[model samples]
Target: MDELAALTKLERVYRESSLLCFTETWLKQDIPDSVISLTGFTLVRADRSEVESGSSDHNLVNLLPVYTPVVKQQSPQGKEVMIWTEEASEQLRDCFNITDWDVLCSPHGEDVDSLIHCVTDYIHFCVENTVPSRTVWCFPNNKPWVTSELKALLNEKKRAFLSEDKEELRRVQRELKYNIRRCKASYKKKLEQGMEQNNIREVWRGLKHISGHGKSGDVLQVIGDQAWANELNLFFNRFDLARHRAPSSLPSRQAIHPQLSSFTPQLPAQHSALLPTVTVDQSTVDQSTSTPFRLTLDQVRRELKKTKARKATGPDNISSRLLRECADQLCEVVLFMFNLSLSLERVPALWKTSCVVPVPKISHPKELNHYRPIVLTSHLMKAMERIVLSYLRTQLVHL
Candidate 1:
């Protein structure tokens, strides 16, 4: 409704055009006709649930090309998407008033009351702004890797091919071949450099481009909420999208007990009863060898700094880049939320939700099981988990 209202404001743009199409209208039967009525155009759409009902309610965007007598454009394609790239990154920084820092250190102080005040303000700011977004539009790559000189030569070669000039065709073909070789070599060298730097994300991005999977697919055909939930459990109970691996080495008891697969070892009954006798020296506490007493601003900051900026976000729709950029101020809110949850022994309802994405793991996978699920959780929830993890780590020492 917001979009259609905005489009109505642009009467001149649509009035001048012959045909206008919306691929992702978010329209359903529940929406009243009055809601979608536009002055200068008719709307045609298909809902995901209605399209080929045998399949899951996914990828259901009805696409029709924007028609205009003014140009030869036809064939509507692609779903609506918010692509996180340099453009989106710049927009986030501008919207949040984040500045470039020489060091990505988090803000800290010993006073909890003061931290809570800062956090309350930050939460209000987020609620007012909502999540920063810019819809991505697919455009042809007019800027080719080939030089202008080579392009001119290619045009001449095209003229030769059309005019049946055999000698000119042969000469042009040789030059084109050399240019192609140079382009491939240059691209290959860049890929090698990314790999050598251990830039896994960069290397993976280049591979996606090489495999012709860089383009975004139909957004209208997106996975439904229920599907995302089931898939989240399937992926995240084990947490694959995180790519977190367990330690290979195991304690003697765990190694010998098959039931202890991924479970933490517990102290025997005799030892459990005597835990009160243990003593600790606060001055001798070493983070390198012991669990933290509580989550610190520094711990949250370290985790955010190490996290990838471009990965997908969860129910809150907060991007990793946004979290990392605002870490200095945001850590307070995160720490506060963690402490509140711990004290109350209850989590926010939103934290319980997730966004599950299906990624094709194998080529030409026909079975539903072939698709791998990648689960994304709320950034706030992750922070809460990290805090709990500190407690777990301390407790595990007894076993």
Candidate 2:
């Protein structure tokens, strides 16, 4: 019985022999490895007898095994949605009305880009300050039919369930069911309205929402990392580099049109007489007839009014809704800027930049070609373009 007990004790020691620690072993260098070593175990030693700071070194070594809790990384947040109110819109218009336009008009030789930047920045500041915004958390598995009210009811139902209250649970469940039905009906109505208006984008969004198969979030997730983003950037810009590459050989003008190289034609008598032989002095020209076509306040206002309220903003972060809402107050400044731009024959640099959004063409996109680039440009620039187009159209009709 004693031998059996000893064998069991040895077996237990061997089973738990992963690590063995010892301290305060008052031995000398003469104590060889054979004396301290055990079978099937390797030994390690730290000799501090010759060191001056033996105690401090021992303390430092003891502190090395301190615990550090693991920190969990958080998921990226969703985009912030601004809540535009009637009062806020009114305030924004009022703010615009109060702003002085003389600063923009005062500088005669000021850069067009600077003037445009100032105007857009001021408008953005006013809108941001006046409008209220909130962040809506979007989860991967979130359903479009789940409204805030429904979520609150769900929480109540969960509490009731935990508390074992049958009546409360039943009441909450009924409310939840009703809300779900109402939300679904409203959502369906919105989808119908989108279809009636022929809004293809909204229609596709609705279909994706119902089917729970949106590729936007998935694409963003895949490209969120820097490695994938760099690869996509290189891939997308490859064509640009190729297009701008210098050619090896150039074609001569004569080679381009071999027949024109030796042919020299003379004008007919009627056309030759029509050509002006004398240069007209600038001072003698009619000032009224030579004046450039200028933009009118009414034209700017009309274009501003035509701006779609819910359209996405450009790189400047200025919304179309603000422009449409404050058309009356903004038309004068826009008129002045447009005329100045016409006189100088220059467009604002800010207007030339656009925000590019990559939209996926397939459900699971692997290649960069599977994405379509959608550009969002400045609404103000577009308004100016429309005014210019109208003027050109009228001029064309007369010709």
Candidate 3:
């Protein structure tokens, strides 16, 4: 206990441990609990001599707590049919004051831009009205195995501690410790039984807790790199050796004009002379001015089929599951919007808005280069792009 107190006074890097076993502690029966307590850890043992033979035991203490997990009761599972998306869509219609089928079939139903705006508004409504999940416990919570009996014993121990009743505190502390250890043993036994009966989930849950699956990573003790961040930064910055692009603003879309005709010696009015020259056939110009590829119902259906369910939404909080579920009816409307977007040669601003999440490549990543960006954009816009890309690939293959 004296050695443990001395060790606690010294600075240490990390202290969280799931299990700590103590061997020999030359502890006397007259020792007080207040002198041998660890603030944040649970006591597992003192010594065999003190408990069994009532003789003084002399050995060092190792402070460790082994947690045993028991099974948790759960409700039966059932199929969940969610209506948030449909309600959101209906809300969108109400916001636009449009009747059913009007926007999809009406000739004057604004363009893709208008449809995107309505969708974005609906997403906002859904997010604003949705309820957030609740947490059952806060940080520094008691262990799951702690019970009412243990809690009452703890209160008695506390009072004895506060009153400076050393002998009484030691007795109460010993009882409290014994009960907690017995409870943990029972919990561990229950887990072993569950495993023997093929309860995989319960077994895994207990194992994860025992292994400290969600605990914070221990910081590395390198001389300069700290927790791998410094070395990672050095490795990532080596690629910035030279500039790849000119340090000037560039045109967003530079016009490309294929040389229609190369100027050469024109046949002098009187002197008939023919010089070889490159020329553009009429067919080349016709292809350049050709309309944007028209999206078909089948193409829309194929794109919708590729949509994934229950994915994170983008700026427009609409879910992919919603589109995939009602693909048959929604494809016609989405296809009409897509065709209009193609003919007009413009993509809506809403379609361009994206949500970017930066994910770290390694533990304790520091620099911007250490993170990879994941951009989430409009699902509808992606579908339309897929169709255009498909058409372009077909043309390239023929070429």
The predictions' CA RMSDs to the true structure, in order, are 18.8, 14.0, 14.4
On the 0 to 100 scale, the lDDT of residue 131 in model 2 is 90
User: Between 1 and 3, whose TM-score is larger?
Assistant: 3
Worst 10 residues of 3 by lDDT: 68-77
Query: How far in Å is the alpha carbon of 65 misplaced in model 3?
Result: 10
lDDT (tens digit, per residue) of candidate 1 on 40-80? 55544334456432233322222233444421332334454
Question: 153-240, model 3: which lDDT tens digit per residue?
Answer: 9899979976779999989988998999998988889799989999987888778667666533333212333555455444544565
What is the Cα-based lDDT of residue 323 in candidate 2? 83
Point to the candidate with the largest lDDT.
Answer: 2
Candidate numbers sorted by lDDT from highest down = 2, 3, 1
Ranking by TM-score: 2, 3, 1
Candidate 3 lDDT for residue 382: 80
Q: Tell me model 2's lDDT, rounded to 2 decimals.
A: 0.72
Q: Please, what is the whole-model Cα lDDT of each candidate in the order they appear?
A: 0.57, 0.72, 0.61
Q: List the residue pairs that clash in candidate 2.
A: none
